[model samples]
Target: MKLYDYPPAPNPRRVRIFLAEKGIEVPTEAVDLRQGAQLSEAFRRINPQCVVPYLVLDDGTGISESIAICRYFEALQPDPPLFGKTPLEQALVEMWSRRAEFEGLLAVADALRNSAPAFKNRALPGHDDYEQIPALVERGQRRTKRFFDVLEERLAHSTFLAGDFFSVADITAFVTVDFAGWIKLTLPETHINARRWYETVRARPSASA
Candidate 1:
């Protein structure tokens, strides 16, 4: 398998952590999104949508999007299972992963795309370009705060985002929260459970990936 990667992006970092946790190291081709390399014709052929973080499996099956690539890795290496060990656990992990994708990742994207000067005319991740709006930045800030609250409430009760075990949900939330500074957003100091969870995740071997 070949993974199209970028060094600083959170989405790709999630995949990196997932692969490291599962002890999977597929050959990789770094796509420099900062240089707009993903928009080139050659890269577009790999993923018609032209996104960084594409996975080309050994069977010539090209998978785009972080979550799909994560699932592919999970299926290939199920030991030390991040998704789950049982049917119910799997469902819970999926539930929390989905929530993190929308609530956590999307909020970060909103904040960055709407606020960053470099993303002046780019709101969505793909090629479509739209004018940035300061109002959207404000809204993103509000949304991030809401997500932090939701995560704090959830973490206050459970050790991990999905359940007692670390899963893809935890990785997703970890990267999103770790990069919160880019968007001028942050995890609240009063969110003790979330803070504790963050510290543990920081110590994971996969986290350095």
Candidate 2:
């Protein structure tokens, strides 16, 4: 079994951090996305979807998507329980993880993809080429700012997004917070709670993984 990764990408970083936190190491092959390596025929055969953070199991089962890959490891090693321990905690982690993806990560992605020259005809990821929407850039920026506000409020009341323990929710949110910086979007100084959460998560050794 091996993992396909592009270290600089946000999604792959999520999986790396997850694996590091779990203390599980998988053989990894880097697919350089910057040079359009993912579109190569060789990689397309491995992952038809043509995205990184993909895992190919020994039996040839391919798992794409960061959360799905993380889930595999969570099942493989249940200790430390990044997904969460109790049923309630699991549900909450799932909920907040989705929020981090949809509300936080996707928002920043939309803004970046729609406005950056590197993503010119690729507003969305995949095999198809789609033109960037100038209007969505503004809308995405607005949504991302709101995401910060939401996180600030949530962080103020809980030690982490899912509560007292660090879990997948925190990982997703932490990655989102960093990904936002690519588009030059950052947490305002006034959002102390969110900033505090960012600092705490950034300090983790797994964060560098």
Candidate 3:
């Protein structure tokens, strides 16, 4: 099995961190997003979605989306229980993971994609391109700040996004926190709980994966 990845991209990094946490190593081929490598006909045939963090199984079936790929690996090795050990834990992990993706990661993506010249007409990822909405930049920034606030509220009471144990929710939240840096957004100093949680997760060895 192989993973098509772009190392600098946030979504791919999510899968990388997940694999690291699971102690599973899959061979990877770098798809250069900056150079439009993912848009190539070769890559399009492999993944019609034309996105990075794609996994191709030994049977040649392709999996797109970071969480989906992570889920596949989780099914392969359930020891780490990144998704969750119990039904309630699984629901919480899914809830917070979606929150991280929508409230945090997508917010950052909106700002970056709409403001970066490199993105141009490619504001959204996938097969089709959408023109950037200049106004969304500020809106995205505002939403990202709100996401930080939301995280602060949640972390102030819980050790991790889901609960006591680190799970996929933490992975998504951790990646989103770092991705915010690309847009020059940061967790405010006053968000002590969120900042503390960030530092704790940042210290994990898998964070660098």
Candidate 4:
């Protein structure tokens, strides 16, 4: 298996952290997304969709999305499991992870893509060029506040996102919240649960990778 990673990007970090936590190592190639290397013809050949955080399985299966890559790794390395141990746990983990991705990460991304001058005319990923809309950024900011409120409420009730144990849901939330700065958002003092969770996860060795 081969992993293509860009270190600073949260999506790739998700895979890297997962790999570190599982104590699994694979040959890797770093794709410089900042210089638009992922948009290059060669990288495009490797992944037609042209994205970092892509994993090429030993079976020649290429996984592009971060969650998909993490799930594949989870299947390959089951012990010390990160997803869940039971059917119900697995389902809830997926449920909360999806919500966090859609609500948290996507909100940050929308703000960046629409507001950042460097990302001008590129509102979506995957080589598409669209006109920037500043209004979208404003909307994303509002959505992020609402997202934090919801996440704080959920997290205040449990140690992790899904339940008592650390799972993929926590991973998704961890990365998304850390990326809040791209949208000029900050973790408020009132969000005690979220802040505590952030500190706890960041102290993990895997998170430092």
Candidate 5:
């Protein structure tokens, strides 16, 4: 199996951290997003979506989405379960993971992609180039601020995003929070619970990946 990855990108980092947590090492090839390598014909053939963190199974089956790739690995090694152990636990993890992605991660991406000069014509990911929307930048900024409050309330009661156990929800939330730094967004100083949880997760060895 081979993992096509790009460093420092939030989506790819999620899978890298997942691999680290599972103590699994697969041959990895860097797909340089900054240089538009993902847009090449060769990469497009591997993943029509042309996204990084694309995983190719030994049989040549390709998986694109970061969470989907993580799920594949979770199925291969179930001991240190990152998704969930029970059915109800799995649902909870999925719920919170979706929330983290849509509410937190997307918001940060929208703000950064639409407002940052670096993104210019590449507002959205994939092979196609989409122009930035100034309106979305303001909306994203507001959503990002609201996301911090939501996390603060949730983390105040739960040890992790999904519940007691550290699951994929925590991973998504961690990456989202960290990625927000790129847009100069931050967790409020008053969000003590969120800050505490963030610090604990940041200290994990997998976070360095």
Candidate 6:
């Protein structure tokens, strides 16, 4: 198996950290997002979506989307059980994972993509370019702050995003929180629980990946 990746991108980082936690090492080819390498015809042939963090199986089947790739690995190696251990656990993990992606990651991404000058006409990710919406940028900033507050409250009672055990929910949340730095958004100093959880997760070896 091989992974087409790009360092510094939060989506790819999610898969990289998942692979690290599972102790799986697959050959990787870096895709330079900043240089628009993903838009090249060569890369478009592998993934017409023109995105990073695409994985190709041994059988030559290509997989896009970070979460889908992580799910594939989870099925391949179940010892660590990053997704969940049981039926109920899996449901809860999925719930929290979706929240982390929608309320957290997407908020930060919207703000960054629409506000950052570098992403001027490329507000959305994909082969097609989209213009930034000023209103969306403001809305995104507000939503991002609300998401942090929600995380702070949730972490105050639960050790992890979904439950006591660290799962994909935590991984998704961690990457989103870290990515928030790009938009100058962060957990408030008063959010002690969130800060504590962030620090603990950041100390993990997989977090460094």
Clash count, candidate 2: 0
User: What would the per-residue lDDT of candidate 1 be over residues 124-176, giving only the tens digit for each residue?
Assistant: 77766678777877777788889899899999999998899999999999998
**Any runs in candidate 4 off by more than 4 Å, and if so which?**
none
Scored against the true structure, residue 18 in model 2 reaches a CA lDDT of 92
Query: What is the per-residue lDDT of model 3 for residues 1-209, given as tens digits with 9 covering 90 to 100?
Result: 99999999999999999999988889999999999988999999999999999999889999999999999888989978998888999999999999999999999999999999999999999889899999989999999999999999999999999999999889888889889999998999999999999999999999999
Write the residue-wise lDDT of candidate 4 on 1-209 in tens digits.
89999998889888888888889887889999888898898998899887888989789889889888888878877977888888988888989988888888888888888977777666877866678888888888888888888788988998988888888788878888888877778778999998888898989998877
Best TM-score goes to which candidate?
A: 3
Q: On residues 1-209, what C-alpha lDDT tens digit does candidate 6 reach at each position?
A: 89999989999999999999999999999999998899999999989999989999889899999999999999989969998888998998999999999999999999999988889899999989999998988888899899999999999999998889999889999999999899888899999999999998999999988
Estimated TM-score for each candidate:
0.95, 0.98, 0.99, 0.95, 0.97, 0.98
lDDT of 5 by residue, 127-158 (tens): 78999999999999899999999999999999
Q: How does residue 137 of candidate 4 score in lDDT?
A: 88
The alpha-carbon deviation from the true structure for residue 100 of candidate 2, after best TM-score superposition, in angstroms, is 0.4
Clashes of 3: 0
Quote the lDDT for 22 in model 6: 95
For model 2, state the Cα shift of residue 69 in Å.
0.5
* Runs with alpha carbons beyond 4 Å of true place in candidate 6: none
Q: What local lDDT score does residue 204 receive in model 5, on the 0 to 100 scale?
A: 94
Query: What is every candidate's alpha-carbon RMSD to the true fold?
Result: 1.3, 0.8, 0.7, 1.3, 1.0, 0.8
The residue-by-residue lDDT of candidate 2 on 1-209, one tens digit each, is 99999998899999999999989999999999888888899999999898898999999999998999998889889988998898999999999999999999999999999999999898998777899999989888999999999999999999999999999999989999899999888999999999999999999999999
Q: Better model by TM-score, 1 or 6? A: 6
Question: Which candidate number would show the highest lDDT if scored against the true structure?
Answer: 3
For all candidates in order, the CA lDDT equals 0.87, 0.92, 0.94, 0.85, 0.92, 0.93
Candidate 3 structure lDDT: 0.94
TM-score winner, 1 or 2: 2
- Which 10 consecutive positions of candidate 1 have the poorest summed lDDT? 120-129
